[model samples]
Target: MKWYALLVVLMVGLGLQAQEEKDIVVKRTLHLMGSTFEISVVAPTEEIGYINIDEAVSEIKRIEALISSWDENSETSKINRNAGIQPVKVSRELFLLIERSKKISEITDGAFDISYASMDNIWKYDGTMDKMPTASDVKASIEKIGHQKIILDPDEQTVFLQKEGMRIGFGAIGKGYAADMAKELLISKGVKGGIVNASGDLTTWGTRETGEKWMVGITNPVEKNKIYSWLPVVESSVATSGNYEKYIVFKGEKYSHIIDPRTGYPTKGVTSVSIFSKRAELCDALATAVFIMGRDSGIHLINQLDGVEVVLVDGDNKIHKSAGIVFDTNQYVEK
Candidate 1:
C-alpha cells in the first residue's frame, strides 16, 4: 500500500472516532412507581442508550414489586398482614430501608413517620371539607400513627409492627428510592450521563447531552404552572414536595395534604418544600418532613443537617431558601 493512501485511511478512521465521541442523548419515559419516570442517557449510539435505559426501568420495576404495600403478594404486604402477630422476614434491602426510615423519623423528631400509612384520611380534599371535624375526632385520626413502633431485627432480617392495625407505607419516599437505584444501575452499566426524574424526585449524575450541568426548575407552589427558580445538580438529587393542588379549604382556612403524623392536622403555612441531597431517598423523605414541620421549625432542622438544602414556598407565594441554597439565576427571567 502507498504511504499517502495509508495516511488518508488513518485520518478517516480518526474522524469517525471523534464523531462517535460527540454527545448523543437518548431518553425514554414510562409510568412506574405510580408516577412518570423519565430516563435520559448520553451515549454514542441510540442502541447503547436504550439498552441501559431498559435496564434501569427493569430495576425500578423490581424495586416496586418488593416494596409496594398495595401489592397483596409483596413482602411489604406480608409484613403488614402479620402486624402485631409475628415478625415477617424481608429482603436485606428492605430491612436497611426500614432502618434508614427510622433514622429519618428520629432526625425529624417524629415529623417523618413511615407509619403514616395507618393514619385515616379524615381531611378530605375533594371539596368535602366544608366543616372542621371536632378536635377529638381530629386527634383520633392519627391514633395509630407512630414510627417508634416499627421494630427492625437486623439478625433476623425481619420487620415487626407492634399494633395489629398499624402499617407502614413508602408513598413519600419510594419514588425517590427507585430513582436513586435506577441512576446507580445506569451508571454501572456505562451510562455516561443522564437523569432519573421520578415525578420531580430527580437524581442526576454527569452532564446533559449538551455537555452542561443538569438544571432543575422549582415551580411556584401556589402557582403550579409557573417556574420561579432553578437549581443546578452535578452529581446529586433534588426532590420537590408541593401541596398546591392537593389541598382542602375548611372554615376559610386552607390545609395541605402533608398531614402531621405526630398530629392528625394537616400542614399549614407551607406550600412546598424542595430538598437537595446526595441521595434522592434522603431528599424525598426530607421534603415531606419539612412540609409537616412548618416553615420555621423545618428551616431550623434543615439548617442543622449537613449536605441538605431546602427551598420553602409560603402560603402567600413567597419563596424562602435556606442558607446553602443559591438559585441558578442564569435561567431565571424576571417578568
Candidate 2:
C-alpha cells in the first residue's frame, strides 16, 4: 500500500515536434492505511464526461474505511476484535471480496489464506533477529491460521471466524480490488480509455488516445530502475509480489517479509512473482499466492486456472512464465 513515487516524465527528443496530445492524465496521492496511494487515470480529453474524480476518490476512501484492518472502527477490525464471538455483517462488496479470497485460498491449497493475520508477529525482518525460529515456534505462531475456520453467511452478508483469535484482512488484495472497482466505475461513467495504476497493481481499459496500447515495464528484480520486460496491456490487470522489496539478514540468511499462512514463516528461494489476469483482484491475490507456492506449484496452479498468466523470477535470476503469457524474448534480454 506504500506509494513509491511515480515519476511521469515526458521526454521529447531533439527535432521532435510538440504536437498537442488529446489524452488527459491525472494523478492524485492520498493517505490510506499508513501509506500513500498514487492513483493515475488516462482518458480522452474531449470526451463529454460528467464523472467527478473527487467522487471516485471518495468512493475509494469509503471502501478503505470499510476494510482497513488497522482502523479500529472498520468492519474488518470489528470482526478481528470480536473473533469467534460474533458474525460481523459487512457491506455486500466486502462480503464478496472475502468470499473470493476464500476461493483463492482453496485454489492455492491454503497457500493464499487470509487468516494469516491471526498469526503472532514472531519473525522480525528488521535486522534484529539472531537466528531462524524453531519448528515449535513456527507451529505455535500459525496455531490459529486456517482458512477453513472462516465461515461465511451469504444471505446475511456476514463473516464469522470459528477460532477465537482468527482474523481476515485484505493486505494482499485490497489495492487491486480498489483499482478494479475504480476502473469499473469509470467505465460505467462512459470514460472511454484509461489506466488505473495502483502502485504496481495496474488495470486498464481501452487504448491510449494515439490508438496504441498502454505499455507497462516490468522491473528487473535484481536491478533497480531497469526494466527486464515490457507488456502492452489492454483491458487487463497486472500485479507483482517480490521478496526483494523487504527482507532481513538473520544468522547469515535473508528472510523475506511475505510470510506463508500455513507455516507462519516467510517463503524463500523465490525472488519475485507477477500475475496477469482480467481482474485486478485475481491478479493481486494470485501474485501473492504464487509467490508463497514457489515456482513449480505456482506455475501449475496458474495453468489450471483459465485466463491467468504468471512470470516468476527465481533466486538465480532465471525467469519462468506461465502458458498464457505471450511476451517477446528480445524484450527480456538481460542487460
Q: Backbone collision count in every prediction? A: 0, 0
* Best lDDT among the predictions, by candidate number: 1
- lDDT of model 1 at residue 190? 79
**What would the per-residue lDDT of candidate 1 be over residues 1-335, giving only the tens digit for each residue?**
00000000000011122233675777788999777777888788889888989999999999999889999999999999998899999999999998999999999999999899998777877776677778899888788788888998899999999998888999878888999999999888878888887877888898766566776666644544455565678799888777756777767777777788998888888767788889999998998899888889999998999899888887787888888987654553322
TM-score of each prediction = 0.90, 0.88
Cα lDDT tens digits, model 2, 165-219, are 8888887888888878878888787776666656667788886555566766666
The residue ranges of model 2 lying beyond 4 angstroms of the native Cα positions read 1-21, 43-52, 220-225, 331-335
Model 2 per-residue lDDT at 262:
86
Best by TM-score: 1
Provide the lowest-lDDT 10-residue window in model 2.
5-14
